[model samples]
Structure formats: structure tokens, C-alpha cells
Target chain A: MSNFSVAFRTTGSVTILALNGELDAHTAPELESAIQHCKNEGAYNIIVSGAQLDYISSAGLGVFMAFIEEFRTLGGDIKIAALQPKVFNVFDLLGFPLIFSIAETEEAAVEMFSKGTTHN
Target chain B: MTATIHTLAIPSATRYLKDVRRFILRHARKAQLPDDAIEALQLAVDEACTNIIEHAYGGSTKHKVDIAIIVDPTRVMVRIRDRGQPFDQQSYIAPNVVALTRQGQAGGLGVHIIRKLMDQVEYLSEGRTNEIRLTKYRTH
Candidate 1:
């Protein structure tokens, strides 16, 4: 079985995805599908909670890059929160912070979406 | 001081990335590397293997990636060998991170991550074999 799984829930206008286990090339597609599912549900404000994410590679990071444009163009946004330091390092190393809003807590991310301050 | 060399071989496929990571982490833990160093080494190895599987083999699964780890008291060295097409290191261009993010590029971060994480990265091609060596120094 794959070591990664994504669970989804809705809090106010934000759709929260709780990711568990490692996120790498093999399991990136699962994340893509979850994001797509959120889009189908008319959720543009998406929050990915990475509290349980043990690791992330370029492939997993690529999944967010692939969909962020579409979400933003549609007046939605994807915010990442609660990333473990190890997982957050990958995003920081790649300069993702410039393009995405990463919060220290899921509630902060939801609040960002609620305030319509998705970027920065 | 001389260190023992340990080797692992896995198919050049994305599915085997988890196994490759596990093997590297085990060696890193045995070497008593710090948590940050272990994570960096793991990411470097994953990016290197992913490049081999995708670019070297053209996403084909027939090739195999052979990884050798040498753990010394102060540093860990990893050598990865593959039987795929030769990689022209000279022609490789570093991605423009700001531009790529603005353009929403989905890929191209693997090579960049590998270079940033590994203390030393060397690529060489001999005959039909391509080899990459990555090294990380132990912080504690």
C-alpha cells in the first residue's frame, strides 16, 4: 500500500485537506485528485493541512504548482498550513513562499481565505 | 579514516522511491546524522533517483539505479549509478525559480533541490553508464 493518504473536509468557505505520511512522486497523483475534487465542489479557497506530513519531494511540491494557477484564476486559492519543518524546508528551498501563502496553523489559513487575502 | 561501503539497487521507477528513501534513511540513522542532515540527504537522493528514472531512462522502468553509501565519522557519501542514457551535464540549465513559479511550471525542481541539499554533487558518464555522487557532512 502507498504510504500517503489525503483526507478532505470543509470549514466555512475553505476546503481543508489533511495529508498524512510521505508526499513524493509516487503519491503526488493522490493529492492532485483531491485538489481536483475540491475544485469540482466549487471550492477555490483550499487549505492543505500538513501536520502529519512526514516528508515532501519536488514531485509532491509540483502538484501544488500545477493547480494553483487554475484555482486563483477561478477566484479560489490554495493555502498550506502546519507543515513539519522538514516538509516546509522543501517549499522554502524552492521559493514557494513567494508564490503561496503558508500559515502556521490551519485556522490561520482558513482565516486568510475568509479575508480574501490568499496571496502573500 | 576508511569507512565501510554499503550498496543498494532498485528499479528505475517512481514506485521504488519509498524503498530507496528507507534504505538511505537507515544508513543515515546508523551514521548518527542530525535530523536536518538526514532529511537533506534523503531529499537529495530522491531527486537524483527521480531524475535518473525520468530523464535518463525516459520514464522507462527497465533500467536500474544502483546506490552506494559510504558512512564515515564526519560525513556520508552516496554514489548512484544507472544504465540509462548519458546525461549531458554541461547543457543543463538551472531553472529560474521566480520565472517558473510565475509561469506555473509543474516540474524542474528536482535538479535544483538536489544541488541545494547535497554538499557536493558530481555527474560523470563512462561508456553506457551514468553515475552521480552526492555527499553531505554531518553537523553533529
Candidate 2:
């Protein structure tokens, strides 16, 4: 059985990807596919909700790095929210907060998109 | 806690990463490691093994990666060994997140994360065997 899964939902123009289970090299491709599916459907504004995500590795982090620019160029950005403290530490260690818009809650992240903030 | 050495051998594939993490978690708990240190060690070791699975073995699952956890009262250390290509440490430059995003690159961040999470990291290659050791000290 796979240890990680991504669920899709939508709020206004934003696509919310609710990530569950562990994200590592083995399961990262699944996330990549999910984001790519979003792109194919022309849904660029994204919010990755980590409320159910138990763990993440560098491979998982790379998925966001790979697609953030593409979405931004399409006039939408990927916003991350609801990361557990332990999961957040990995992102923080890699200085992700400086590059990605990481909000404390899903609603807060959706708010950022609605406010039209470019790099908040 | 008594000092002990534990070992787990798995195929050099991403699918086995969860088993590696579980081994580390079980051993680290037995060693009474602090929660943060355990978490850091888990991530650091995972990064190291991922590198081995991807760069060392070239995504070939036929190879094996042996992970050893050495635990003592003061700290815990992990030694991962493989017979694949050794990583050229000299050529590794720490990645800049903003620059990576601008260029749309996803990889080359594992090494940096390992260095950040572990107190000491060393890479050794002898003939056909390449090993990366990651150590994290317990905080009182």
C-alpha cells in the first residue's frame, strides 16, 4: 500500500490539494502528477493543505519548487497551509518560507490568493 | 541507555524508504533519543538514503543499501553504505531556494537538508563501497 495520497478540492479559483500520509521519494511522483493534473485543467492558483500530512522529505519539497514558477507565470501561485510543526520544520530548514507563501491555515492561504498578493 | 548498533538492509529504491524510517524510529526510541533529535535523524538519514538510491545506484533497485544505527547515551549516528557511485562532495554547492525557484529546478536540496539536520555528516568511499555517516547529538 502507498503511504501518501493527495486529494483535490476547489475554493473559488484556487485548487486545494489536501495531502495525507507520508511524502517521500517513493510517493513524490504522485504529488507531481496531481499538480500536473491541475495545470492540464488550467487550475493554477493552488493551496497545498498539510493538515493530514504526517511527514515530508526533500523529494516532496522538490515537487513544490518544480511547479511554483509555472503557476506564478500563469498568473496564479501555489500557497501552502496547515502544516504540522514537525512538517513545517523541514520546510523552514530549507528556507522555504522565504520562497513560498506558507500560511498557518487553509482559510488564511485562500485569503492571500483573494487579496491578490503576489509573493506574500 | 546502553550503546548499541542496529542494521537494516534494503533494496536501493524509493519504495523502501518507509521501512528505513521505521527502523530508525524504532531504534531511536529504544535509545531514548529526544523527539526533535529523532525527527532530525529520521530526515537526515532519509535524505542520505534517497541520494544513494538515486545518484549512487542510478535508480536501480537491484542494488542494496545497508543502514546502520549506532546509539549511545550522548547521541545517535547512522551509517548508510552502498556499492554504487560515490557522491562528489567537492562539487556540491548549497542551493539557494529563490534561485532554484526562478530556474524551476526541484532537486539538489537533499544534501543541504542533511547538513542542516545532522550535527555531523561525513562521506567516505573505499574501492567499491561508499558510505555516508550522519550524527545528531541529544540536547539536554
The candidate scoring highest on lDDT is 2
User: How does each model score on TM-score?
Assistant: 0.96, 0.97
All candidates: DockQ: 0.74, 0.92
What are the clashing pairs of model 2?
none
Output the chain A TM-score of model 2. 0.98
Candidate 2 stretches greater than 4 Å from native: none
Off by over 4 Å in 1: none
- B1-140, model 2: which lDDT tens digit per residue? 57789999998889999999999999999888888888988988999999999999899999999999998878888999999998999989999888998889999989999988889999999999998989988777
lDDT digits (tens) for residues B15-80 of candidate 1 = 999999999999999888887888899999999998889988999998789999999877899999
Query: How do the residues A26-83 of candidate 2 rate in per-residue lDDT, one tens digit apiece?
Result: 9999999999999999999999999999999999999999999889999989999999
Q: In angstroms, what RMSD does candidate 2 have relative to the true structure?
A: 1.1
Error of 1 at A31 (Å): 0.7
Prediction 2 global C-alpha lDDT: 0.93
DockQ, 0 to 1 scale, candidate 2: 0.92
TM-score computed on alpha carbons, candidate 1: 0.96
